[model samples]
Target chain A: MSVEHVVSFDRRSFMKVATGVITGVIAATSPLAALVPSRAWAVDLGALTDAQGAALLAMIRTIAPHDALDSAAYALVVAALDKDAAASAAVKSDLLTGITTLGVGFAQSPESARIAQLKAIESSAFFQGVRVKTLLVLYNNPIAFAHFGYEGEAFSKGGYLFRGFNDLKWLPEVPLADSGPMPV
Target chain B: MAQFDLNDDSVAVIIGSGAGGGTMAHELTRRGIKVVLLEAGGRLTPADFSQDPGAAFGQLTWLDPRTQSGTWDAAKTSPNMPAWHCKTLGGTTVHWTAATPRLQRYEMEARSTYGDVPGTSLVDWPIDHSELKRWYVLAEKRMGVTRRHGMPGMPACNNFKVMYAGARKIGYKRVHTNYLAINTKARDGRGGCIQQGFCSQGCKTAAKWSTLYTEIPRAEATGHLDLRTRSFATRIEHDVAGRANAVIYRDSQGNEQRQKARLVCVAGNAIETARLLLLSDSARFPKGLANGSDQVGRNYCHHLTSFIWGVFDQPVYAWRGATLAGVVEDENIHNPTRGFVGGYHLELVALDLPTLPLVGMPYGWGRGFTDLIDNYRNLAGMLINGEDMPQANNRITLSSTGKDANGLPVAHIHCDDHPNDIALRNHARQQGTKMYEAIGARQVVTSPGSVATHQMGTARMSKDPSQGVTNPYGRSHEVPNLFMSDGSVLSTPGAANPTLTIVSLALRQAEHITKEMAAGRV
Candidate 1:
């Protein structure tokens, strides 16, 4: 159970049955994947055509829209999708077809139309596929956590010991009986 | 530390070094008994733990395939991975939140008190609560549990503050940051809780009371405990008279290694323990080892649990402290008026942004789903740990079409909720909502039925040999020299967490075993 062991799971086919868990090894294998011929490895956004990258980014924003994250954070997810698409040509084709069939360009469409289109394509393999892998790349990022008002990284910061761990002001006072010298 | 020779027959061979097995090994070794502890998983040190839940989950979760059946929501939500027990050196204790609640007095005598609840397999423990009280105290002190032995309680994190405010508003009296096996001020050799909030993922600071830092190491220091990790026990070989003589396991090199044993103890969690018993069927005990009553794999219990999240108007930063902070103990007292025989405790559960989506709901989308993640700071969570009734049919059976890496039939867990469990969950839901709404909560969301935190009663204890697999001392009724030192021997699933009870029973079992050994009875 180290990060090394988790990376070892990249070779396990049985472990890839789940949606969210399939996002394994992208961080570890991405650099190596850049070495493979463009025909096999899809590790960079440069490998993805302009329409494919825009459509995937559009899909990711709909999955987890944030007002605060910089364009770089959004670009990180596009890179992740690009990696998956590079590995499977069908994935790229599916993304393109799904975006085309929806008949509303994600970047050009209004918020309501985009939302409605995304909801309609919820059952598609393209949407479900990206939804699982995209979140792993996006939400798990330390940058996204800060933008979303979350303090995700804890163990390395020597934990929240003297931090604002107990600083809550919204709640009312607890009776002394509840906070007794002796445990109940 | 001295390693026991493979041919040595005088040493005790204990399988699966988790809470029960590790504790028993430590106690036995400290008393000058030789013990060879075999663990199926690798050693994941405190240094290996990560702050990220996603990465930590990969490190801690048991990914070995298991097929789940039955009406329980976990069956559908997490079919392949039913219970979230860690397959590591310290077993599930490495991944556990370390919530150690003692069983109430009435919980031990479920059959006598509950009385003929339709469609269930209720039974009383061979031993009572009074018999375990001394051991429980010892376990608490040893683990440095908060609010016990004058150990200061962990500070109330933002999540716990929400729990306290709500519990107080709802007039819940028996509530505080209750018993936790976490360091508050650096007890023993380990440092105090740094408020890492990632105890669920292996504790990197060694602040959690896992055998990895505590018992297993202490046992090794005695030079009487031989700790072998990544050695999977496949069979317990017996002599001509049906007493276990040796254990056949796959070592780290994937080579089969057989170690001679004077006594054998099985603590591979409920599922693996039962499966090992069933797989060890012989001409003498045709059904399985110690399965004369056909009761080895019966009566599996996963506590009826529901995770309730309360979204507030202000930032709560629920994940700022420990994964779990406090408990609401007022509801732990049994009352028949609630239409359930047992009671439940509400414990704090704070999932971060990454896990909230995967576990909070199976598949969520649209603005509502996105909003949940958007307002992650404003949400606080509590989990209901209610006792589930044991049913004879809810069991772990070998799959006909499947086999694992070692060619053993895959374990298929069939869990069906009893009527009492359903009724109790409904009751908890009603009370939980009121408790949250009392403090001006905006909305309450029930997490997807979870992978079981507690699993018990696959190999139950009973005075009668015909009714159970093990005797009062956790010795096998059929196999005199064989034992089960784990939660699998629990007679009934208590509302409280099972680790404390499992450790107490292990201590009691070790005493009985040592005496038996000295008397030449085992």
Candidate 2:
């Protein structure tokens, strides 16, 4: 369940990191960063600074808090936002301004204080955009899918026909004849 | 494989290729008539369909920008998307649940059965039930529908088992896996369903009947159909004699092309069908083609729909079977004692884990929301497919400002739920809660209605030309050679899903067109 054990970073992605400074920010100071493995897979950030990325991750985790989930799942949202922000100047400015509005040390603040700050600006476009993107990316990730016991894509495994499609043992068995007459 | 000349005036031009248009193309081509079928979207085979819900939605959905103005929940939640229908070659049939319930006699005669319902434009179908019943038999046979014509019903899955037991526990008798146009055993040259559970994602196994793999291909095999994919029809032009003679469309390369026709049949579902007709306005027919009565885009109806979920203590594995394979049909019968003019069916429904939070549940975040996702394996779901009253004001009109990629005015949909629709939904929700509670449900949650998938009654059929856009056979009252072959011709939004009726009407329309062509009338 640790973030270090879940995320695997290849050499190409490690080299793609904009600077060693951002990697140091994630690995050294961030509370969640302390759990990073020795080969720490610092995510590539094109439009967001290391502090902005950390705040965004904290904000996402606060929005969709699952105590059982790893920080790697929340980091995926920041990665996606950074990618969007890199593609659009409007998105970069929005994220920068939105993070600035959250005030400094937002990611370092206690959970209750962070929650109160988020509540005050819950109606803002920035919060709504980040929330929708987090929901889309986080729950659809393999980490969330595995944690929730969701068997994704049955067709590749020959579907659920023989794999307990009708194998509910808790309920009384429904008779096949209960389907009634065939149209003649 | 057939390629008709663009100037060929001997071919019938059919617009959209879902159940209605696809079936029409097959029937006409088989009868030795040449056809030029125009579909706005590109074609995709079962092999191209994705198991991922998000990817499949982008691939198959009609993502064209549409405007919405209404008091319905969709107007607020999905302001840009008022209706949900496919734009692929098979149209919405590619995304349909394949439920094939026949319309009851009373549902067709809404005027006689629900007398004097104020603020509604209720009208009896010009074609009687007995007449349409004949074609329904043919449509069912053609589609190899399970639970009909000696075909056995699909095996009960965990979702269906939960629904059947709960429905029976609540004193309902006529509950079973629904009559679906999917195979239980291999028939009609298609494989049996392996219960893959993504029935809406274009039916990867081809076990579910879709025109993409069935009628359209069959029409191509006959060598009498010129199937044009990615051809967006802009307008229908007519001759001086007031007969539809050509269709102007944008081709795949964004080039404008006009294909001449002997006649035209429009089957672009309800919204697009109405919009296309309105877009065809000419000096000769000022308001729009075949719109002499100004009834072309009036009386839009999408059945009152909502999802009701029951949370159980144990796993139901609702997403293991066909997406919608169970039904409770007893409530589908009309009885004034139920505090509604019409009735509704409670059909089993299940959304995948990724989709459940987005649409199945009320919008929320944090622990309260994550708790529901944690119980995703224990949720049993049902959908209310109830009759929604048709208001004359609930209609499709051309947006004055918004234009599509092709520079045509986008359709603006306006709908405000009638009181009867609200009542039917409330009653259905209560009954659904009781059924689940009878079988030991810990919690019941009801969701707001999603976008209209069962679109109908925009361009309706009527005995009086002033009351409707088409005649009993779906032929336009103003133009002799123009016909509407889709759900747009439905006189009322019956409790049943509109696909079966849409197919039946297409079958009947094809027969009528063949006869009319032989007699030299059209």
- For all candidates in order, the CA lDDT equals 0.80, 0.86
lDDT minimum window of 10 residues, candidate 1 chain B: B359-368
Query: Could you say which candidate leads in lDDT?
Result: 2
Top TM-score model: 2
TM-score for each predicted model, relative to the true structure: 0.89, 0.94
Candidate 2: true interface contacts recovered: 0.58
Error of 1 at B182 (Å): 1.3
User: What is the clash tally of candidate 2?
Assistant: 0
Candidate 2 per-residue lDDT, tens place, B1-522, comes to 999899999999999999999999999999999999999999898889988787898899999998888887678656767788999999999989999999999999999999999999999999989999999999999999888998888788888888888898989998888999998888889988888899877798888999999999999999999999999999999999999999999999999999999999999999999999999999998988999898988999989888899999999989998888889999988898888899999999998877787667766676776777778889999999999998899999999878999889999999998998999999999999999999999988888888788889888999999999999999999899999999999999889999999999999999999999999999
Per-residue lDDT tens digits for candidate 1, residues B148-235, read 8887776677788888988878898888876889887766999888887888888888888998879999999998999998899988
**The CA-based lDDT of model 1 is what?**
0.80
